[model samples]
Target: MSGAGNDAAAPPLAGIRVLDLTRLLPGPVATMQLADMGADVLKIEDPGAGDYARAMGPVRAEVSQFFVAVNRGKRFLRLDLKDQAQREQLLALVDDADVLVESFRPGVMAKLGLGWDVLRRRKPTLVMCAISGYGQDGPFAQLAGHDINYIGYAGMLANNAGPDGTPALPNLQVGDLLGGAQSALQGILAALLAVKMGGPGRFVDISMSDAVLAHNIMPLVAVNNGAEAAPARDLLTGGVPCYNVYRTADARFMAVGALELKFWQLCCDVLQRPDLKARHWQLGQQVGGADALAVKAELDAIFAGRSLAQWTETFAASDCCVTPILTSAEALRHPLFQARRMVSQERHPTEGVYWAVAHPIKFET
Candidate 1:
């Protein structure tokens, strides 16, 4: 909806055709990015249920808000893959599609007679991307998993914890969004580029677990150095005072990311605790050590002495990477997003006006 007309102003993917046979969050979001970039995305669903997300969450007007959020700017069609006639119809669509994205279990497509081999043989230039929990051929290929399961298996859950050492559930679906959607998008773009360069079409295999594991970098570094990555104790976690979260007087939280020595020094000066500047990580103070904990406790007490508003005003002019933890509603009204044009309102046929997030990437003509 953002960029659909005028050849000069059309988005980069204007002429590309994408056949999306995915459902739920990850795959739909992936294709939604394509739709945002002006790809002609056609979403195919089974005749019986279509996308399960249509009934998964709160219904606004007649359709699910979850479905409408990720399924914008796409043409929809229903065809039961089990039916021979419907399967053939899908193939006909595929013949003209530049990219095909699916998120079924590894062998399900083959069982439905629409596997990558069949597709590639039919159209050698087609880029096929398959997103699964594990991978196409792996021990856990047949296993069922959600975002939590994938992140847990990748050791990400263990590292994400609080002072109590209990793994906190994040509202963001890391595995589904990062591992599935982002990984699939990266592969699809790369494959499309390869095809455009006159190379044979590539089959993109996206394993959510694999992607999660690959990105768990900091922990892997510790493991490679022959040390265990303790929960809630890593440098980037809550181990140090320079980069941690503190509670304010009103029970609100503030995120402190003054990782650099200069920023830490400035933060200490703002807190009127210049004495604490010497006890920094760069000054050879061991992270998560007793001294670090003591410093964190002192800063925690200081932060709790003031309300969030008082602290915000106190650090208004400082550039120490300190910020108040804002809720989603607050973020929507924040000046940063408003100035960036990251949020917009669209009127659905029946749902009236709904807020939508614009694609983050920007291109200058």
Candidate 2:
């Protein structure tokens, strides 16, 4: 309750203390979001080798850039949970912590004698979040898995494909980020709110696979309606000509999201193909049907006639929901991100100037 007084300028999570036992991506990024909002996040690592991410990917000044990017704005500590003395020390720290987030397998924390039952007996108001590939007490709870496995289990991987209908591995870790991190964030915040209202603390069990499965909404809708949810044959998944990716003469890609008829008409106008506007999904043109594929092929040929840069310029002023597919490096330099300050450089003590992605949340004060 340090900064819980009525102060308009104080950060939202100013008084919150978070004990982070998570390493690598999902758990670390979740706590980092809290830290960005002025929570005091203490990332506790084992005294042995510490977080494996410290050695993952490219290194700069003896630290992994991957680790540096996700673990910014947090304090660090090391303790060996196996040792009684160190375990006692962690328990003492837990006494002062408002929240604890961990990403271990289901039974590891219970085996450590630091399970939710023990912690809740000691402190009833402590919110604990457990993040894992599968939910606690599930058939796959004890099984080891990663982002790819989780998304595949959630039925998302099957739908993420191209015209060839082969499942494509996405560069974005949707299962890890959306499923684990964001879901845990939501649970933690809701539990914190409940505690603020004088309720007992809650245990948040986050399963990456379960989360992604819950969010794979469109395909589920189709299945519930007794329709087939085929790969690359769904409305949002390259099934419709108006919402597909097209390759340009330079082999670069453009994302078209002209789903609505208005946007489709605008896109047709920009492409100088007014005749194509009548063949929209709303108008009896079946999605993933022969007509739709023919229209997509026609659009593809038209797009391949020009360079990506030329198409980008052609659609710059049109509100047709068409945009060039930018690489990660190009996205960092894009004017949209620049204007919003999404990416900024922070001087790490050892790593020098490293790029940091700003928290997307904004508060007016």
Candidate 3:
């Protein structure tokens, strides 16, 4: 029930109008980004329950943190598409809208008489984007899925496993963010550009699972190159000690991303392990082999000798690519984020002053 306004000067999408008939994370996030860049996004919700996210996550005075976090910088409207009056009203709005975004299972909008076929016929120049678990007209198009299911089906989860060989449950919704929201955003922008160039507006079908599968480029490349491409076998996926996470003395973790030879050499010098410099990934040592494991163990022990604070101090001025793994709270207070203004102070009707995560898109005049 709350909204945040953007005050930026002459945003690129200043005249764009977006009708967002999406409920949860994916579609809302896409429209939020559009709104942040000066699109007049009208978030259309069902009259009964509105967005299901309104009751999800932590709530203060019945306002869901999850909903508030992503629903900023847009206007809200409640309409019942099933009703004749509301449907007519929506059609009127569509006659003037530049874009329409939806995130329903396949056939839901078609059943409601608001499908792309109908909308495109009504306004040929309007870009319509449908975000779903699977794309339209696929065998699994109507299947219900979430982020975990999509990533798991895409084989992304298996590649990102813990030390115990179990797939780690990522806190960040990789499939939702990258596959759904970002994919939809890219398609919408492309379609908008096409419309600007006098090309017909297109229907953008964003399948989260398909997007994740397409985004699995590294593994795909490995498979194409006739490599095993198994879990933990790739050079970027815990196969080498240079690009990995190490536990520090205080139980905190430090991320090591010294992927290049020079950075790896600097890291070895920082850890006083010049002997291990020759064991770099490009030196023909088998990735995920005994040698790599042994070097990783040695680096682990060296990193465990120092706390995260000490390691931070040691590599503060070095380009060794070693950094402390920060908690969400620590990340909010970090100087790098503070300098970028990633979070901003905002006021809610009931919660008063609260923090809002700012959109990362920085536009220049």
Candidate 4:
């Protein structure tokens, strides 16, 4: 909270204060990143249930993993914007705050008499980030949607999933967490720069659908060039051997990502097989091809020869891009992460000395 130049242990965002009015993944993840960077983040939740994600199925003795994953390092304040007095209190909270992020539906904030326009007037230098499923003025702006809906509507989900041409449900909230979180975070940073450059703080309108579409820029380009509707059928998705997951002898999997020629060559060399780099080893030019399948099969066979542990030991420092597929628990126990202090037991007032993902960051003087 002091001058940014004097402190070294202080985080990059040390003096920045964030008023988090968003619940759930998109906004919370962004604010969590900000908090990890030393911003003072205050989460404003509804009085009773708090963020709806608190009730989602995955739980830690009642606290949802969804909630725990993205809401750390921040103070919580329960405020109901529906109440006139509470709305005034929230407006007051934003008065001198550096940034405010909210993920309500397009017009909901204006309805509550706390829109960005009014807030900008009250706090001329406050950066306001409004996150929604769609943009503020679009036809689908008022429609309620989730991560899947956002990706699907953006033409990303339908093509990026499925195995046998059947559209598979995306397991992770990729669109919401990655797309919206990145968009909002970037907007907040840009807003901060705007505040520094001149006088007024900026309003950032971030649409989850737009974020998803932006994420699919490369694939969208391919589609625009007449690629198939279901593009996951491409070599990069699963059709190729050097870039896919193969089960080891013990049923644990190995993830191989030798996309470039040299990486693939090294993988073949490490596996003690010269047959993989054959003239036909390269993935063919026309979409998915036989070369891709052959390399994948060769990699699968090489990966299958040993148990995951043996493979892990054998290639611990080798140049091949092969890696063991890890579960969350195993990843949490990995030596590099342990050495980096990426996982630690942080005492949560409610949860108590629970395992927490340490902020994967550090500051030096």
Candidate 5:
């Protein structure tokens, strides 16, 4: 099944030729998905250092774990873009490619004589995806930034990052992977469809900042407009006790998420905490100004009385709506994640055994 042709044909992208010119997280993650889908992804790296990510430790065989995670299944082509010869060769390659993706600060490509305008003239049916921190024309367009910076500009990190305590990087590359790379991929795919509709390849201008805004639309709306979009004050954020983390007898923790009244009651019933039977979302709202210290104390005591293992076992049997909080290492071994292949192990040429967070795309086969 790992090799070509199992149940589904090789891939939906078998015939497509992609030239990946992006490095680091955003661009690489997008192309990795395309490569997994069976496109011919030729990754062009700088001949001098290869990719900056390749030397970023933890390094293996001159390839970093960061590099392998995203650059898999692609043929690596080392080209010195500064050299006129290499630029010529790259243009020749683009003439044959169906798609081209780049994340260099805008104008870098144009200065190098490999701009989309010139490339498109060479091949009419080529899709060009340009990814940047802001966009092509905004005041911040040329201003360089990374995942956290773009997230900050988009106001997602500002909302999620703490003023209550320490300001933390919110899962750093998650935003870039989702907002930039994935968005760029969707653009490329849509352009591919447009090609079939009798248009030439399209230029997809993807802005990481703009994409993050899209990602945080719901939360942004609440903040900008009214109660609907604001977070942390919401039930799922931190407002309700039913939808929060709970600790167990041991140092380990369990997440309690009984969003509905029936679910909340079920948790209370299962835990034998009848004193808090009436504490639901609607009830919590009335007691908003009042400290629910008594309720918190009771649940804390109940959770502290049981070991994490016991709580997990109990949750497995009854639908009390709670589960243990496993660390990343423990999570891989979790039966639920293993069954779904949520975590996969790969023998990285340098990093030995490394794990890949499986892309959420499922197939018919």
Candidate 6:
């Protein structure tokens, strides 16, 4: 594992001050990433209840695990945005702060008299990022939405369906994590870079729906190439059996990504099924056809003959890109996770020991 350096060799974001007026997942996660990179992040919440996530999910002595999972390495403050005095206090922070992020619906910040126009006038070089369902000037800008709604609007949810063709509720918040938080962070970084290069500080308008739509590139590529790009019909979806999930004998799952002909051949060789080697997406096997279906069924039977552990053990050192579908707990205990130090254990003075998911990006000096 890589060692975290000393205070003098601090992170790139050191000396940056961020004012985060956000709740729930999106904006808080963006600021959390900033705070992890050594920004002095001050999360300002409402005086009455603070962030809604504080009371959500499983609580350990009044602290929510979900809240702590996203809101680490940051300071917290309570401020009533409606109160003139509190708003003035936030504005005072904004004067010296480098960035301000908010995830309110359209017009909410303006209603509080702390909008970008007002804040930019107060501090000319302050970067402000607003995260919402849609952009500030869209027809659906003010519409309330969550991860599912935004991905649905972007035509992504339609592609994610169950085996019975029913739309499955996804556990991963792709729209929230990818679209809102990551997009906001990227825009904030760009705006900060611009200011560092003597450019004007700007308003970063992030629409979750727009960001998700922008990420639906594969299916759009299919459509543009005159191919059918419906749900589960595209190559990357489930059209080919080379890249798919198979059920094990014990009812657990294994993910197979033997996409290339060589990898597929390697996988078939490992399974001792030389006959299946020729049945590949690139080997004239009809995708979504009877032959493909039969091959998948054959694979299903073969995989179901063994337990997840057995199959994983068989393919452990192979280059076929096969892995067991591990649960969250199993993932935490996995050797890969341990080696990368993706999870960190810290002993809080009052709260005892707590494990946190670490940032993925690494900067090498």
**Candidate whose TM-score is highest:** 1
Q: Write the per-residue lDDT of candidate 4 for residues 1-365, one digit (tens) a residue.
A: 22345553566898899999898789999999999888999999999998998877656576776688789889999998899999899988887699999998888888999887799889999999998888888788888888878888887766766566656776777678767898989988988988899968899999888888888765767678886534454656776666778889999998887766688777777788867665223644333565666666667777788999998788777777878889888888888789877897676656555667866556655
* TM-score of every prediction relative to native: 0.97, 0.96, 0.95, 0.90, 0.90, 0.96
Local accuracy of candidate 2 as per-residue lDDT tens digits, 225-261: 8985567878998789999999999999999999999
The 10-residue segment with the lowest total lDDT in model 2:
1-10
Q: How are the candidates ranked when ordered by TM-score, highest leading?
A: 1, 2, 6, 3, 4, 5
In candidate 5, what are the lDDT values of residues 168-190, reduced to their tens digit?
67655646877788899999999
- Roughly what TM-score does model 2 have, to 2 decimal places? 0.96
- TM-score, prediction 4: 0.90
Compared with the true structure, what per-residue lDDT tens digits does model 6 show for residues 209-301? 899999988867867889755456456777777888899999999998998999999999998998889888798987766777678888899
Model 2: CA > 4 A from native: 1-8
Candidate 2, lDDT over the whole model: 0.92
The superposed Cα distance between candidate 6 and the true structure at residue 360, in angstroms, equals 0.9
Clash count in backbone of candidate 5: 3
lDDT of 1 by residue, 101-131 (tens): 9999989999999998899999999999999
**Per-residue lDDT over 58-104 for candidate 3, one digit per residue giving the tens place of the 0 to 100 score:** 77876688888888988989999999899989999999999999998
Off by over 4 Å in 5: 1-8, 161-166, 224-231, 282-294, 349-351
In model 6, what lDDT does residue 106 have?
Answer: 81
Please list the C-alpha lDDT of all candidates, in the order they appear: 0.92, 0.92, 0.89, 0.80, 0.79, 0.87
Q: Over all chains combined, what TM-score does candidate 3 have?
A: 0.95
lDDT of 1: 0.92
